[model samples]
Target: MTLSPSETARYRRHLTLPELGPAGQERLKCARVLVVGSGGLGSPASLYLAAAGIGTLGIVDGDRVEPSNLHRQVLFETVDIGRLKAEAARERLLAINPEITVVAHAFTLRASNARELIERYDIVLDGTDRLSTRYLVNDACVLLRKPLITAAIHRFEGQAMSYVPGRGPCYRCLFPQAVEAVGESCADAGVLGVLPGVLGLIQATEAIKLATGIGEPLIGRLLTYDALSLRFAELPVSRRRECPVCAEHPRITALEDTAEACAADAPLSVRRLSATALRRLLVEARRSGPGLVLIDVREPWEFDAGHLEGARNIPLGELRGRLDDLAGEGPPIFVCRSGRRSLTACAIALQAGMAAPAHLEGGLLEWVAAIDPRLRLVAG
Candidate 1:
C-alpha cells in the first residue's frame, strides 16, 4: 500500500528510527491488533498504535464514557460521556490518523464470542479491569495463537507483561491460584491520574515493538511499577510445568468460561453468620458501653431508614478512601440491603488492614427480618 502525502508526513518521526524505516512502518501499517477494553490502559495504547499507523486496529469495549473517566482516559472529554467507548475511540483515532483502519466493537467480550472475535486479529491487548476478563482474554489469545500484551492498574501501582505463543510464560503460569477477592478496584481505591497513562504508554510501546519486531520484549519478564516510591522493577517469569492451561499434560483443550469459576474460586471476605449468632452479638452490644459499630455500606438513602439503633453510614464506594476517618473500632459489622455490598466492604476493610471488621450475616435485609421486621430499607 502506497502512503499518501499526509501519512508520509505524520509518520516521519517513525521513519527516522533505524528499526522502523519504511519497511517496518509498512509492517505496522499491515498489522491487525485487537485491544480489549477501551478504558484507562486501552485508551492510550490504542491511540498510540493508531497514531503510529498500525494498519488495522480493533477496539472492543462494552462501556460508555463517564465524567469520572476524563481524569485518566485521555482519549475522551466531558462531551464524550455516555457515548460508547469503542465508537468514541474509533472516531478520535481516525481523526488523528486517517491513514489507518479502526474497527470498533461496542460489546462485552464474553465466552460465547471471545474466541471468534480474537481469531480475527493478529495480536491481542488485554486492558480489562477484572480478573475474569483477564483470564478470558489470555485463554482466547493462547487458543488463537495471538500475541498478547497485558497490563493492569491499581491505586499507585500496576504491572505489565507480554505473552507470545509457545513462548516463556503465560498469565496462568504466574497467577496459578484463583485470585482472592479484592476489596476495592480503581473505582473504589482512587488511582493516581497519571499512573494508568504511564503504564498504558508502556503497554503501547510493547505492542508497537512486538508488531515491528524491534526490541527484546518482556515475554518472560513481569514489569512492576510503584508510583508512590517512584520505583520500577522487572521480575523474571518462568513457565510452570504444572500449569493447567499450558502444561505438558494440558487439561484445557478448549476455552472455558472462567468468569463464574473465578468468582467461585475467590474467597468471600465476610462469612455468613446465623441469625442466632447476630442475636447473641446484639445482646453483647447492648451490655457493652460502646456496642458493636453496625455500619451500613449501602447508599445514603438506605441509611435514612431505622438501622440497628445507632449504626453508622458509609457507602461501600467511598469506604476505602475514608478508612482513616473511622473511629477506633469495636467489632465493626458492615451491612447493606443484601450481603453482596457488605462482602465487598469486608474485603476492602481487610485489605486496608482494619481490625476485626465484620459484616451483617445477610446485610440489612437479614437484619430487618431477624431483629426488626418493621424497619424499611430504601435505596439511594
Candidate 2:
C-alpha cells in the first residue's frame, strides 16, 4: 500500500534512514502486530509500535488500571485506574497515531482463544508476566509458525529474545521446563519502575526490525539488561534437538495450558495468608496463646528500610540453615517485599518439618495496602 501524504510527513525520519527506507516504512504500514498484556512491558511496546505505523495493533489484557500501576505502566493515567487496560491503551495509541488501526481484545489470553487471536496477527509480542502465559504463547507461536518477540523483567534486570519459528530457537528450547522458583514476577519481586520502559522499547525495536527487515534481530540469542549496573549482555541460544516444540519431529502437536505444569512444580505446603487473616491470627494468638512468629524473609537491606514491627528478619537463602532455630516457636508466617521469596521460605520451613507455615499472600505489599497504609512499599 502506498503511503498517504500525512503518513509520509509523519514517518519522514524513518523513511530517510538507509536501512529502513520508504519500502521498509511500507512494510511497517502493512504489518499486523499483536501485543499480549497491556502492563509495564506492553505499555511502551504498544505505544512505540503504534507510533511507528504498524498497520494493525492488537492489545490483549483482562486487567484494569490500578493506582500502583501508574509508576511503570505509562499508557494509563490516574483517571484510568478503574478502566480496562486494553481499552485505555487503544485510546492512548489512537491519540498518538490516528492513522493506525488499534484493536483491543479486552480479555485474558487463554489456551482456548490463543491460537485464534495469534493467527490473526503477523507477529506476536509476549508482554504478559506469568510463566504459564509465556509458555503458552511460545508453544502457540511455534505451532502456528509466527514470529514472536518476548521480554521479561524482575527487580533490576530484564531480558528479550525473538523466536522466528524455524529460523531460531523457541522459548521452550532455551527453557526446556518451567522453573517455578525463578518465576517471581515484578509484582512479587518488586521491579525498578523504569526497567520495563527500557526493555519494552527494546521489544518494540525488535518488532519494528522484524516488520521492516532492518538490522539483525535478537533471534536465537537472549539480550539481558541490568538497570543497576547499566550493562547489556547477549547470550547465544541454540535450538534443542529434543525440544517438544519447534523440533524436527515435534512432540507437541497442539497447545497445552501450563497451569498444571507450574502447579506440579510448586510446593504443596506453601500456603498464602492474606494480611488481614494474618493480623487476626496474631491477635487471636496474643489473646489466648503464644503469639505467632512473624518472619521477614527479605534481605537485611530490605528489612532495614521498613518491616512489620514484631517481624524477625530471616533471609530466604539463610532460612534453610536456620530451620532448627525456629523449631519451638509458634506457627511462623513468612513475609517478603512481595510474597515470592516468602513462599520459598515457607517451603523451606515445611521441608524441615515445620507444621503449616504460611507466607503473606502478597508479602509486605499486601501488609502496606491492607494493615498499615503508612508503611512504604519500596521497589528495587
Candidate 3:
C-alpha cells in the first residue's frame, strides 16, 4: 500500500527510520489491533498504536470514565467523565489520528463475545485489570491463535509480555491457576499515575515490533519494571507441557466465563453482610449473643495507619496459618481495606470449619462510607 501525501507528511519520522521504512509503515497501516480495557494500560498503549498509524483499532470496555481514572487513563478528559470508556477512547484515538478507523465496543468483554471480537483483529492487547478478564482475553487469544500483548501495573511496579500461541508460552503457562488471594486494585492499593504509562508504552512497542516484524518480541520471556528502584529485568519463561489451553490434549476446548475465577478459591458457605447490617449484628451480639469478633484482614501497617475501632488485625496471608487464634472467638466478621481480602478471609474461616463466618460487604471502605464517616480510611 502506498501512503497518501498527507499520510507521508504525518508519518515522516517513522518512514525515515531505516528499520521501519516505507514497507514497515505500510504493514502498520494494514494492521488491525484490538485493545481491551480503556483504563491505565490501554490508554497509552492504544494512543501510541493509533499515533503509529495502525489502520484499524478496536476498543472494548463496559465501564464509564470516572474522575479517579483521569490520573493515569489519559484517553478521557475532565469533560468526558461519566461517558462510556469505549466511546471516550474512540473519540480520543480519532482525535489523535483521523486517518485510522476506531471501533468502539461499549460493553463488557465476556466469553460469549470474546472469540468473535478477537477474530476480527490481527492482534489483541490485554489491558484489563480484573483477573477474570485477563484469563478470558488470554484464552480467547490462544484459541484464536492471535498475537497478544499483555501488561499489568501495581503501585510503582509493572510487568509485560507478548504471547504468540505456537511461538512460545501462553498466559496459562505462566500462571496455571488464578491466585487464591488476589491483590488489591489501583483504587484499593493506590498506583503511581505514570506507572501504567511506562508499562503501556512498552506493550505498544512490543505490539508494533510484532506487527512490523522488526524486533524480537517478548515471547517466552517476562519483562518486569520497578519504578521505585529504577530496575528492569527480563525473566525467562517456558511453555508448560501440561498447559490446559495449549497442551497436547487441551482441557479447555471451549471458552468459559472466568469472571468469577478470582473468587473461586473462596469457600461457598460464607455469607456477605452489608456494613449497616454488620453494625446491627455487632450491637445485637453485644447485648444478647456471645459477642461479634470483627477481624481486620489487612496488613499490620494498614491497620496501624487507620482501621475500624475494636477490630483485631490478622493479615490475609497469615489467616490460614493462624486459624487457631480464632478457634473460640465469636462468629467472625472479616474486614479489609476493600471487601475482597475479607471475603477471602471468610472463606478461609469457613473452610477451616468455622461455622457461619461472615465478611463486611464492601470491607472497611463501605463501613466508613455508610456507617461512620468520622473514621479515617486507609488504602490497602
Per-candidate Cα lDDT values, in order, are: 0.77, 0.82, 0.82
TM-score of 3: 0.69
lDDT of each residue in 1-380, candidate 3, tens digit only: 78899999999999999999999999999999999999999999999999999998999999999999999999989999999999989989999999999999999999999988999999999898776788888888988899999887777777788999789988777665555443333356678999999989998998899899998999987786779878775545678788879888888888887635332222323556778888888788778956678888898988988877578999988998988988887778888876767756765675576776788866778878899887776667
Minimum summed lDDT over a 10-residue window in model 3 is located at 261-270
In candidate 1, clashing pairs total 0
Stretches > 4 Å off in candidate 1 = 260-380
For model 2, residues 63-124, the per-residue Cα lDDT tens digits are 99999999999999999989999999999999999999999999988899999999999999
Among all candidates shown, the one with the greatest TM-score: 3
lDDT of 1 at 3: 66
Residue-level lDDT of model 1, residues 134-241, one tens digit each, is 888887787777899988777777789999989878887766444544454335567788888888888889888888899998998878677877877555567878
Q: If scored against the real structure, what TM-score would every candidate get?
A: 0.68, 0.69, 0.69
Candidate 3: clashing residue pairs, number:
0
lDDT of 3 at 101: 96
Quote the lDDT for 130 in model 2: 73
The parts of candidate 2 lying over 4 Å away from their true place are 181-186, 260-380
